[model samples]
Target: MIDPRTPVLVGVAQFVDRDSLSADALSPLDLLAAVSGAALADSGGRGVVVDTLAVVRLFADSSPAFRSPFGSYANLPKSLAARLGQAPRRTIYGPVGGNTPQLLVNLLAESIRSGASDVALIAGGEALRTQARAQKMGLALDWSEDPGGEPETLGPETRLVSAHEVAHGIAMPTAVYPLFESALAAHYGDDPLAHRRRIGALMAGFTRVAAANSYAALPVERTADELITPTDDNRYIAYPYTKYLCSNMFVDQAAALLLMSTAAADAAGVPVSARVYLHGSADVHDMILVSQRLDYHSSPAIRAGAAQALAQAGIGVAELDHIDLYSCFPVAVEIAADMIGLAHDDPRGLTLTGGLPYFGGPGNAYSLHAIAEMAARCHAAPGSKGLVFANGGYLTKHSFGVYSTDHPANPARIDPTLLQAALDAAESPPFVESPAGAGTVEAITIPHERGIHGPATVIVRLDSGHRALAVIDTEAAALIDTQVVGRRVNLTPGHPINHARFE
Candidate 1:
């Protein structure tokens, strides 16, 4: 018989509220409670074993000043538990990251494997769409709930980027990811036009998958030319990233997963068909600061985590029947594919849930939907394996998991710190918080706001070979539409800002 402590995922559910503009729209807590309850019902209706509940942190909850147009919950996990009438002994609120959902799963699996917990529920939800719509219509939604008392926070609350990065306007994901995009394009020797078409084709495939998914936020299929070719509707948010290429965060979506030890599942009488095993998982992070990365074209953390996960599962990439690489941007997917040794047109599609762009990002909870989908796929095709790759920050944190219906003959083992130590040991390029004199432009991104051009932000290699960020004025921004990498420029460092000009 399999070890009673072997952790297995027994149930998963996802809820997408496309009609959040209506009166029936659920708040974030409500969505979480509903999905958690649904997951319980899906898993043989066992309520006695829910000793732990973990919730993925929400973006709106990060700021004390962010008053939701729909009043928000003070304690998300506890409020959700009360609504479901499940008194879990421990409540956990995870950190902010696209990788949190999967990371939590890996952590909870360890807890169950150690016999510290018999069962756990992991859930997350976002009602940003309803909040935005209500605010636009000048209506106030009262989703306020104070369950009292704080839950134990699971992850660190440290800032992901540095003060220097923020000073140079390299803070937001949109601005920073495009720098990676430009570098990746250059690595492939593709010109501006050619690279645009290539990424467009890649995203168009995602849109087609989204069109077929019932829960996709924007399910309309789009063509490669339609996606890459900017129009009045799909304007450029940042160069090389049109509106269609970015993650759709304006979505009301929620997902939940229930994991129980094999003994608990058996006691609950969960059908054999409903069981999915957690074969292997690994979490790792690259250099926290993008400017300090060894290179821009790839992610060593992703490569390390993926390899470790597959190795732990005793399987190879060829055995994966389904895959869902985090698709916050085209570059994310492309870089992940290259690192995982997956071809762009692999027999197994890159995304199992369309992707973040089409399926809906839902803040940090996007990967929860991917996990839910992967669980369902495993149930449908027993013994077939699926892979879920999640990323956080600007390709800084990564987590990988492999799942299947077949239980491993060997015990499940996860070394959470191995990948992290490897990342920390890797050499980081020297980064200058501020630099002066002549420099060579390594990569640049010119962002647009509502079809209007903005200042150009460039990552330059200074005379000393250290990387620094600089912003160019409108005069220099005009030259950004063309290839600017390798262009010699002069940098003038100022208080909290640095200016650059083409030589």
Candidate 2:
């Protein structure tokens, strides 16, 4: 029997507009109320409102004149609480990261399982494009302006990057993901053109799925060639990465999920007919900084977390109907598919929210949209199971949740500490600071010396016909100016004319 205090995701909802026509196209408060109300309605039309409010941080739209006086952190919980007409027993504002929503759900589930509280709402929204349009039109749109201290920060407590990585331009999402992609490419010995095509094909499937999703912000389908081929319109942001291959975060969007204890749901007269159990989940972390990794092509934390999640649910890849593998870029999916024993071209397809690129990555809350979609799909498919994987902090933090129509075993828990310990034990190969004479092709970004300027990560493979992590002291201008990307260079020890490679 399920525990009376077992926390479950009782309802899920999402909202989006084809275009942000007005400043309030999808106001943060309105989105919260709509989704919360829908979640409540999904819970058998119960009039009961959420008693605990956990608001995800909303990123402000830079274009609009909207000052967001309360900052993205301060206004959401109070606004949601007012809309629900109930004083939350407790309120929390989370720190930034794409993984926040699932992390919040996990915490709420534990709270319900432990009887800390019941009937909670987890919600967030961003109206970026809408605000941008308003700025262009010179129209003033109404928004919350209350002020308060910043919410308690919640993210990796430690600095993932060392001073050296940042100094050399190893920061930012675009710069980081390409490093992994390049590593993946080198691992397979695929030429640049072939690798780009493979990634485009992988992401095309996600765009197809998004095309069918009514709430997808950018729902047009693109072919693999269209996505991967670089053009003036889609310039290369980083080596081996086109603009289309990156996550799109400029749209306005929001999603919310309602959670309740089994007892609380029953007491409120809500039926369990549509409930999907959070059967099992696992959260783990890899190296926080890219520079510390032994291998950029793979993530041990992702592999272990997915394994634990599937094991806890007593399921495997062969039995699953749908899977969302956190498609921030082609490399993420490629690596996740490798980890979960699913092929890149698995007939089941990889995404249900069209991946982050097409569906609009709404800050840290986008994966909540994936979970919401999974719940709806399971509810519709009867016995089918779905997986939602989330990532944060440059592929550093990962959380996986398995959901199914059947009620899960009572008192389920995932001890992430073991996974973390395993991650800590795993060793990444040291970067090659200097290599013997070998032919190399590389891309180097010479960042401006101003605030955080330097060439992002560059790849220099030894001519030994194998991928090599060529490291370098990037503070030297000679090393930064080399056009190593899409070109061949001779690596001679102590006689280098154009670049230096070593860590």
Candidate 3:
């Protein structure tokens, strides 16, 4: 018999506003309420009490690039709670990371299973596109609110890039993901042109799904050439990554999820067709710093997390009927698929909501929408299995969940410490702040200026087997056309950061 305390998702909702300039544009608070109301109605809950409410960190507050000129909300959850007429016993605000949504659901489900809580609501939204348009058009907008109390915080907030990596002009996702792309290409022994074509075709599949998704920000389907080829509209953000390859964060989107015990679902008369159980779940993180990673092409965290979740679900990768691997960039998907034992071009399909690049990556809450979409899929096809893998930071943090319409025999949440400790104790290469002399390139990222080539940033392994970061200025044609990984280079330590020249 299934545990009465087992957590099941009863309701989920998503919202997308394409017209930010409309007279009735919703603010962040309004967006949360919109999704929350829809989710509550979807659950068919009548006078159901919520003991916990959690809100994912917003993009504007997470990064300076998305920073809003408007004042901040003192307590984001309280604001949402007050707006929704919810006085949950515990209010929570999640930390900054794309994995926060799935991580929260996994942990909160464990809470419900343990009877620590009854019903819980998770919600998040982003008005970034609206905020940007207002700012650019010199229009006044205010997202600030004071709800009068501090909420308990969940998850970690760490500085992703190190001082050294930033010094070498490697800071944002656009610059860093290309490092993985280049390394992955070298790992597969593929040429630059062929690799581009391969990744282009791979991501083209996502666009096709996006074209059909009403919630997708970039909903137009694109081919391999339309995706990878550098044109005026599709400029190269970084080598091996065109503008289309990156996640589209400039979209107004929101999503919310409602979870409660199976007993609670039955008490509320939530229909069996609307209920989706958590078959398995796992969350883990790798070395935080980009330079401290074991390798560029793969994520140890993904491998470990997926293994734990799959084991708990009493299923293997081969059995998963529906899947959505986080797709912030091509390498993120490539690495996740490689580590999780899913094929890059699996006929079963890789994304449920097109993915981050095509679907609106609404800050840390993108996976919530993916999970919501998964619930709808499971509801349509009973007994079908689905897996959602979410990544945060530079593929350093991971969260995986296995879901199904069929009730599981046993609880699937397990202590991740055992496997997580093993990954934590895994050795990483020694790092050097500054270095001189001969070394070999592990990966390289070239920045483009106004669609033209800029200086190239390189990650090198010194003759002493120590990793270092450096930069070199050269003709675009020199490094652009040819694969430079494994090429010899001489490094020279200098102020600000180290410099390297091709040898």
In model 1, what is the error at residue 75, expressed in angstroms? 1.0
Please identify model 2 stretches exceeding 4 Å from their true place. Answer: 61-75, 136-139, 147-158, 429-456, 459-503
Better of 1 and 2 by TM-score: 1
TM-score of each: 0.97, 0.85, 0.98
Q: What is the lDDT of residue 339 in candidate 3?
A: 93
Per-residue lDDT over 1-503 for candidate 1, one digit per residue giving the tens place of the 0 to 100 score? 89999998998989997763876677888889889988998888454469999999887876454357666678888998898888889999998889999999998998999998988999997888887888888876788888899888965675788887787778778878999989888889888778888998888889989999997888889999998877899888888788999988889999999999999999898988899998889988888888888888999889989998998889999989989999999999999999999998886899999999899999899999999999988888988999999999999889888999999765567666766877888887687766898988888887888867688888999888888888976453465447777778899887888889888
Evaluate all candidate structures by whole-model CA lDDT and list the values in order: 0.86, 0.72, 0.88
Where model 1 places Cα greater than 4 Å from the true spot, the runs are 45-48, 63-67, 474-481
> RMSD in angstroms, all models?
1.6, 5.3, 1.3
lDDT of 3 by residue, 66-123 (tens): 7788778899898888888889999999988889899999989999999988899999
CA RMSD (A), model 2: 5.3
Query: Which of the numbered candidates is closest to the native, going by highest TM-score?
Result: 3
Distance from true position, residue 266, model 3, in Å?
1.9
The candidate 3 region of ten consecutive residues with least summed lDDT is: 472-481
